[model samples]
Target: MSVLPDPGATRAVLIGTSHYDHLESLPAVSNNLTALAEALTGPTSWTLPQEHCTILSNPTTAEMTMAAVRAAAEQARDTVLIYFAGHGLVDPEGDLYLAMPQSKQRRVETGLPYRWIRQALLNGRADRCVVVLDCCYSGLALGTMGGPSDLADQAAVEGTFLLAAAAETRQALAPPDETCTAFTGELLDTLQTGIPNGPELIDFGALYRHLRIRLAAKGRPDPQARDRNTGARLALGRNLACLPTTATTPSADGEPATARSWPSPSGIRTVRGFFKSLADVRVTSGLTHQMVSQRSGGRISPGTVSRLLNRESLPKTWHTTAAFLSACGVPDQQVAEWYAVWTRLLTDTTTDAAPHTVPHPRQHQKPTTLQRLTGRLSRRNGRSRDHRSGSS
Candidate 1:
C-alpha cells in the first residue's frame, strides 16, 4: 500500500521556459506552470503551502539550479516534486538537457543538463522525489547509459519517479491554439477534474495510466514513466471526479450514510486517544477485523488489527497503522495527518524513556578498619612533622 506525502513537509518546484534565443517560442509553457502550481497547492490536491511551491518563469540555468538545491535542502522527511515544461535538447552523446531562455539550438552549455537535477535529488534529504518532464526527448531521462529501452540498468535514485512527455526519439506536442502544451493541458485537466469513479487520491501510477490513454487517444506522443521503490504509487492530489453528489447515499468506498459522523484522528495527542479514534473508525467502517486485514493487502494480520484496537498503546510500526486506517476507508489526507500525530507520540514515548536528571539513591556504608587506622596515623604524623620541621 502507498502512503500519501505529508503536505507540510513536501516541496514543489515548477520551471518553465516559453521564450528562447534561437528556438521557437512556446507561449503555452507559462500557462502550464501557473495552472500546475495552483493544482498542487489547491485544497483539492496535496494542500501544499503556497510558499512551498516555487515557480520560475524563463529562469537562467543558475537560478533554476539554486532553487532545486534550496528545495532539496529544506525538504528532509517527505517528498520533493520537480516539474519542467519547455524544450528538451539532446547532446552529441544523446544525454538530455532542459532548454533555458538563453539557450541556443544544439548548444549544450546554454541549457541545464538533466544530470544536475538528478544529482540534486540524489543528494537531497527527502524520502522520495518526483520528476515530471514535459518537453521533447524528455523520455531520454529514463534511458540508461546502455540503451534507450533498457530500464533494468537505470541508475535512478531510490524512491524516485520520472514521468516524461514523449519517447526518447519523439518530440512532445505544443499545439499553437491550445491554452497549455498538449501534454500538460491534459495533466491540468486531470488534476482539476480527476478520473471518474477512480481512486479517491490520484497517485502517480494512476495518473500515468490516465495520461497514456488520454494522450494516445488524441494521437499525441505516448508518455513514458520509470519508477523505483513504489514511488509511482505516491499520491499528490485528490480525485475531484470521485466526489459524491449526495451525502445520503453510500459512496464509492462503501461507507454507510452515517460514516461521515465517524471520529476524527485530528488533534489527538495521547496514545489512548489515538486508539480510541482508530476504534471509532473501525466501528464506522462496519468491517470485521478479518475483512480489514484482507483489505490491507495482508500487510497486517487479523489478530494484529484486533490487538491494535483493543490495546491503548500506539502500534509499534506505522506500516500497521496505515494499513489499518486505509482498510477502514480513511482518505489519504487523513492517513497522512494520522502519521504526523503518530510520529509525535512515538517521539514523546522515546524521550520519556531516557535516563532522568536526578541520581538514584544509594545505601549508606560504614568505613573499613584499615581506612580508620590510616586516618588516625595521618593526623598524628601531620602534628609531629609540622613541629619538627619548624624547629629545623
Candidate 2:
C-alpha cells in the first residue's frame, strides 16, 4: 500500500544555487530558497516539521545533491516536494540538467540531469511528488525542449507533477528591484495570500490557473504545469483569507490606482445584469474590446473582453474585474461600482443558476531552443546534505 503523507511526515528539500563560475550569477536564488523554506514550514502554511525540511545552498556537485534527494525520498512517508531555483541547462541530446557551482558549459556530466532526480522520486513511495523548477530552461521539467504543447511530455512521468517557470527560449526574468525570481515572486505571493474568495485548500490546478492569469497580466512569459495523475489534488496552501488583502498604488496627483475599499454588491441581482452593466459602460465610454485588451497590456484578451460582455458569469478573482474596469476608462471613484457588482454576485442566489466556474484563458506557446549535444556527460560529488534553514 502507498503511504499517505501525514502533515508531520512530509519531506522537503529547497535548493538554490547562485554561484556559477561560467554563467552569470542569479542573485535571486539564495533569497528564493530562504523564503520558500520559511513558507513551507510556517505555522499555518504547509506546516511541515522543521527537521523534515532541508536547504542546500551552492551544492558543489551532482552526485552529492541527488544522494540527498534520494535519501529524502526514502524517508518521506507521504508527500515530497523539491523546489530548485538556479540555472537549468539543456544538454545536446535535449535532456535538461540543473546547474551547480562547479558546472561548466558543454560539460553535461558536471550538472545534475533532471531525469536522475525524476527517477528517484518515481521510485519512492510518496503519495504526491511535486517538482517546482524556477530557473532558466525550467520548461524541461515537462520533457519538451522547444515549446509548450497542448499535451504535456510524451514520456508518461507518473506520480510527479512539474511546474515550469517559462516555456523554452524565454528566461524566467528576476524582477529588477526584487529579491526573488519573477515566477517565484508571484508564487510566494500566492502562497502567502492564497486565492481570492477561493477555497480553503488552494489545489494544484487552482494554483496554476491563478499563476497563468497573473503572469499573463504582467506581460511576462507564461508558466506551464504537467500533472500526470488526474486524480491528484495537491494543496499548495490554505486560503489565508476569504477575501484577498488590499494594497493601493497612488498616481502622481495622489490618486489611488486601485481602490482598497471593499465593494458591496448587494444591489446586483444576476450575473447577466452584472456583465451587462460592464458592457453598457463600454458603450457609454465609447471604448472597443480591442482597445480594452490592449490597454490591460494583453492581460485581459479581446476574446475575454467579448466573453465578459457577451457571457453570463465572471471569474471569482479581482484581477480580471479590476483590469477590465481599469481598461474601460472607469474613474477611480466609480470603479468600485462594477467591482461591487461582481463581488455581490459571488454570494447572491443568481450565481447558483449561472454556471459560475471560471475559464482559464490559455497563453500562446513560446518558441523552443534546440542546442546540439556531442559527448556523454558525467556526474561527480562530495559527501552529505548541507545548508542552514532560515528557521530556528
Candidate 3:
C-alpha cells in the first residue's frame, strides 16, 4: 500500500541504563529493557530476529561503545532501529547525552554523545533508521519540536527518525509498581494491542501519536517524534496480536504468523475516494465490523461503520472521523490531510456547489503509482498522474 519498498531486513540495538556509579539508580530502567527486548524478539512487535538484535543492559564503556563498534547490522539494506531507556543529561550547551553506568556529571565526555550515535547510523548502509530515546533529555538526539524535521533529504535527516519520551528540560517519569517507565509502558501497550484494533503495519510517527494520547490521558508529559513518513510510510512491523486470524493467517489466538500482504489501492482523491481507500485498508487489515465496534467500546456501532463506508458522505464530526480513520489504519499525519479534504468537499457538495457535482477524478479507473513525495493523486485523461514530492 505504501509507495516505498517493504522495509528490507530488520536490525535493532536495545540499550537500558539503570545503575550509575555515583548518580541515582533507576531500577525501572532494567525492567524497560527486559520487557522491550522480549517484545522486539517476540512475534508481536518488531519481530526482530534474535541474532539481528543487540541488547545492552547498563553496559559499561568496554561493552557498549557507540563509536568503536560500527554495528555491521547496518551493512546491508535494512531497517535499523536503536532504542535507549535510562537517565539522560544535557551539556552546558544543551546537547543530549545517554547516561551509562560510567557516566559522570559535569563531564560530557563520559556520557554517550548524541553526535556519535548519529554518526554510527549515518555511516551504516541501512535503508531506514529509527532512534527512540526514553530519557529526560532525549530531545537532544533529534531537533526539538517545531524545528526543521524534513530530514527525508539526507540519510542523517530522512532515513533516521527520533522519538523522545519527554522534553529536554523534563524528567522521564517512572511510575512505581509498573514493569517499565510510563512512556515505555504506553508504547508497549500500543504494540501489544494495536492503535485502533488490529496489528496494521505502521510507522514510528503513528506509534508516537498513540503513545502520546494514552500517556496524556494519565497526566503524563507529551512525547515528541521526528518523522520521515510525510512522503512514504516507513512501517516498523506487523504485530499479529492486533490482527484477526483465519485459516490462512495468524491471529491473537496463538496461530503462527506467516508472510502476507494487505490489500490497498494505489491512492485516493475525493471524499468518496477517502472512504473507498479506507474500506480497502479496513478489510485487508483483518478487522471485522464486530472488531471495529468492540475496539470503539460501543461508542461506534457496526451498523454505523457499514453505513459510513457506503461513501454517501463524510462523517459529520471529527470524533467519528478519527475513530473510522483509526480503524482504517490511517496514521496521525495523514489523518489531518483526510479530515481537511473531507471538510472542504463536504462544504462544497452541500453549500457552495451542487450535490454530487464535485469532480471525482477517475472514479472508475485503477491507479498506477501513488505519490511518494505528496498526498495528491489525480486522474487526467482517464490515467492516474501522481504529484510527487521532492527526492529524499
Candidate 4:
C-alpha cells in the first residue's frame, strides 16, 4: 500500500512546568520547556520560526494546556508538533496523565487526561502530528494507549506519531546541569546537531535508534522505550524538503521563508538592554518587584536584583533567564515584545543608539530572610542536579 506523506507547513506548541502548588514535585518541568523553546526557536544551525511556536510554562491546569493544543492544531497547516515536559502520574487503572502546575498529589484524578491529547491529534487536519512527552512514569501510561498496528491504522486514517520518555514503570530524569529532561535533551541535541539534514529529510528510524542508544547509555533503559521507539519510527515516502503539490510559487502572501540573521554583538546588547528595563521597572515599582521576586521562587538576591536593574549583568545562562522570567511572571506577549525589539536592534542598522552605562549595585538593601531561606532550601536540594532517568 502507498503511504501518505506529511504536509508542508508546520506549527507547534510547547508546554513545560515543574513547580506544582500541591503536586510536591520540585521546579524541573519549566526548565525543560525553556530549554526546548530555546533550542527549537533560537537562531541555531537549524531554525524553526519564532512566530510558529507557542510556549507555556507552569500552566494552571491540564485543561489550559489542552486549550493551547487545540489552538495550535487549529492554526497548523500541514504538520503539528506538541512537546510537553512535566510530571506524570497514573490512576488505579494505570492510565497516565500529565500533572499541571496546580495539580494536587493526593488528588491525582483531577489531572489532565492523556486521552484528550490523543484525541486532539486524531481530530486535527494536519497530515502529521508528533507529540513528545518527558516525565517520570510517562511511559507506563503512554504504553497502554495504543501500538504500531493502531498507529499504522491511525496514520492511515489520520496521521499522528507519539514519542514518550520511558516505559510505564520507568522514570525520566532531569539532570541538574542540563536544561531539559534526559530524553528531550538528547532528542533535541540529535535533532539540532545530529540530523544530517533537518526533519524533512532525516531518516526517522535512524533518528529513533540514535535516541535509543543515547538513552540506554544513560543506564535507565525504559521498558516501553524500545517498543514505542521503534513502533513510532517513520519514513516519509517522498523527500520532505520538496514542496507539496498544493504548494504555490512565491507570492506576496506566500513569500519564501527566510531567517532574519543577527550579528552577535547587537543581539547580546539588545537582550541586556531589555532585561535592564525589566529590572528597572521591578526596582521602581515595588509591587512589580515583589511580584516578580515571588514568582521567581525567591531566588533573586537584593544584590542580583540591583545588578539586573542597573543593567550591570543579566543571567548568563538560559536557565537563569527562565528562572528570572518565571519569577517575574513575565507574560509571553511581553517576552515576545522583547524578542521583537532585540531582533530589530540586531537587524536594524539605522538606529545607532549607544549602550547604556550600567549603575553600581545598590548598597543599602540586604538579602531578605525569606530569600536566604529559599536559597538554602534550593541549595540543600542540590539545585544544579540534572534530571535523568538514572539520577535519583
lDDT of each: 0.73, 0.66, 0.60, 0.52
Model 2, 1-392: lDDT tens per residue? Answer: 11113444468998888777777677777888889988887643555657878999999988788887998888875578888877777677767678898776556897888888889998886767888887664322221222323213522257767777765454446765777878888988998877887654566777788888998898777877888674236666555654322223436654346433221233234454355345544543345777778777889998888876666446767787788877765666577766666667676645575697777866865433432121111111111112223333
lDDT of 4 by residue, 295-322 (tens): 4567875455555655432343444444
lDDT of 3 by residue, 1-392 (tens): 43222212556778887777766666787887887888776543444546667778878873355633257335435467778777676677656677777777656777887667777777887666777877653322221211122211111345667777764234446766777777888887776777776336655666767777887788767777776645225555454354556323434643224433543323333454455455654655566777677656677789977877774566767787677665544555667766676677677557745654767688767545665323443344224323232332
Candidate number with the higher lDDT (1 or 3): 1
Winner on TM-score between 2 and 4 is 2
What is the lDDT for 296 in model 4? Answer: 57
RMSD of each: 11.8, 26.8, 20.6, 23.2
Candidate 1's TM-score? 0.63
Candidate 2, residue 82: Cα displacement in angstroms equals 1.0
What's the TM-score of every candidate structure?
0.63, 0.57, 0.56, 0.49
Q: In terms of lDDT, which candidate is stronger, 2 or 3?
A: 2
Estimate the overall C-alpha local distance difference test score of candidate 3: 0.60
Top-TM-score candidate index: 1
lDDT of 1 by residue, 1-392 (tens): 44456555678888888877776677888999989998887755665667878889889775556666566546645788888887776777767777898876567898887777778888888878898887753322221111133221232455798887765344456777789988889988998889987776678999999998999899776777889888987876666786544323436765445544344555354565566557656654667788888778898899999888877566667988898888777778888989999999888877886765566656676778999999999999999999999999
Provide the clashing-pair count of each candidate structure: 0, 6, 6, 19
Q: Can you tell me which runs of candidate 1 are displaced by over 4 Å?
A: 137-157, 168-170, 248-392
- TM for candidate 2 is 0.57
Q: Quick one: best lDDT, which candidate?
A: 1
